[model samples]
Target: MSGDEKGPVLQFATFQSSVDEGFWHGLSSLKLNKLKTDETPISIMGFYTPCSNPHVSSHLTLLAESLPTEPSDGLPTATTHGNRNKCSVPGTLYNTNTLEGYQSLDKKGLLQAEGKKIWEDIRSGKAEEDSSVLLRFLVVSFADLKKFHFYYSIAFPAVVLDPPATLVDLRPASEWFTLEEAESVSACCNEWRMSSLTADVPFFLVCISSNSNATIRPLKDFKACQHEDQKILFAFYDPYHGPNNPGWPLRNYLAFISARWNINKVQFLCYRENRGFADLGLSLVGEALIQPSQAWQDEEHVPKVIGWELNKERKVSRRVDLSTSMDPTRMVVSAA
Candidate 1:
């Protein structure tokens, strides 16, 4: 738990199913971890709904298995281990069964109608189905003492569908930056343009600290210590952005290191507080420096937050050098 022993800690709140197969595949294929689900959870929030029918329960289990494995701590046991007998109702699914059900639901509008009926039935326990169950999973990881929590929420269309498709098939918008790209953007300063597709929606600014030993000091005590050399992963998202915000949701994820590790050096990543100052039309803080270049004028889409390192001296360093990775033509900062 000492600062020296702390390594990069991946922390995010996600459904239990998300950490199962979907998470494991991404981390493993990306070579993020030698062992899946090795990170510990610091906190978790989840919701659940009961399944009314044994068959539906089985399908739910199958769907859960399709998700990533790293966040599997809170999922139903039947889904986690292919163990139907252990649970009061065993959940299972077959590809053919799923496909046929989807096709039928789509053709007859049964998906929508039946989905509504299923919701009513589950809540009322009147439907002839076996048992009703719907759940949400939230998980957070620390190097140690990882946290996992689960709860129940109203079922939505996405939940009715077996193993929501979005979770299973997702790709990182940009590959992990190469060492060269990371270095070049380190020193370059350029005018960056960013636009949130949804102005009304609040977007998340996620930063994964590169410093293995970095700990999240309480907000009250954060300003004291230094040593800001942290590798930061950045992403942004507006849930209102249709099916998904590309990788914005994932990018905006924030990891707060354990405060117990280091009481003095408290640090966490977040958006520049003054960013929206212009939206308020506030006067410039002081003399403003203006530089013009075709590159500067080019419209580039960057995340709302820039990921950088702040040294103990309070000097900031860029993590992913966007200067080179950006689309030169549009001159977009493209954070998410």
Candidate 2:
């Protein structure tokens, strides 16, 4: 309870990028036919599901369906609405004309640019209205159609906390809540998850009354929830199965809670699942202490972004070559 006695700094599990072969094929078609020699930033969607298998981490996946059917007009494409199986997150694709251009690209600058959008969304209540915008991503790439190779780097930018959030306590949701409260919360969360209306909503407010009656509300209702005497916990569909750390999304979620609600002390729920069902044992409950800075109020100030994915402990672009399988001539040679 003492802010002076800092607990362990919060750590977040980073997202891994997975590009489907179909995505590359679709990009090839778009490049050859529609986007010839163009280096414009195209709006794309990335899909990810909650971590069901603890052994295998969930990835931010780019499939053929992620691309727009028509040319992009610098706006977000359609989302995987009402689909709990696949949550669609908006992203940008900067397909460079040449590999040199991709390599020389300012990674930090690009991350900050996207990070600023997230900041603006949090400031303007857009994130509260549509929580999906908090998951914006960037992929800078160079597709070599000649060789059927693709070089790209993905970044899931997170707004950096100057002092960082401190963990007050962390435990399984079952341990944190009373048996009655847990039951009520589980039932409420299942209803929210099963409903086609709110299944894909990644962020929400969980209100628990003194009698242990729990209800889930959208993030936009934060102001209303504040007036209620019920205990409010910021909840999100956590895509991590780590024993201790929450997922990357919490970084920006914390920022939104602090900036919008002016809540320095936060009680949060990392909602995880087991085999598509709510598992309070797998879920976690934690209290975080955040010291919101006044500098965040400045419209011009951009918080430091901190989500470039590491490749084998180093920050670098990953290359994928699909010539043998995708190329007709290569397939013929192999078959012969």
Report the error of model 1 at residue 105, Å: 22
lDDT of each: 0.22, 0.87
Regions of candidate 2 where Cα sits further than 4 Å from its true position: 1-4, 71-79
**Candidate 2's residue-wise lDDT over 1-336, tens digit each?**
334687978878887788899999988888898889988888899887766655666778899988877565544455567888778888988999998999899988999999999999998899988998999999899999989999988999899987889999989999999999999999999899899898888899999999999999999988887898999999988888886888888889999898888899999999888888788888889999999887887877878887877788586688889998778999999999
Please give the lDDT score at residue 187 for candidate 1: 16
Clashes of each: 66, 0
What TM-score does prediction 2 earn?
0.95
Residue 281 alpha-carbon offset, candidate 2, angstroms: 0.8
- Which one is best on lDDT? 2
In model 1, which range of ten residues has the least summed lDDT? Answer: 279-288
303 Cα displacement, candidate 2 (Å): 1.0
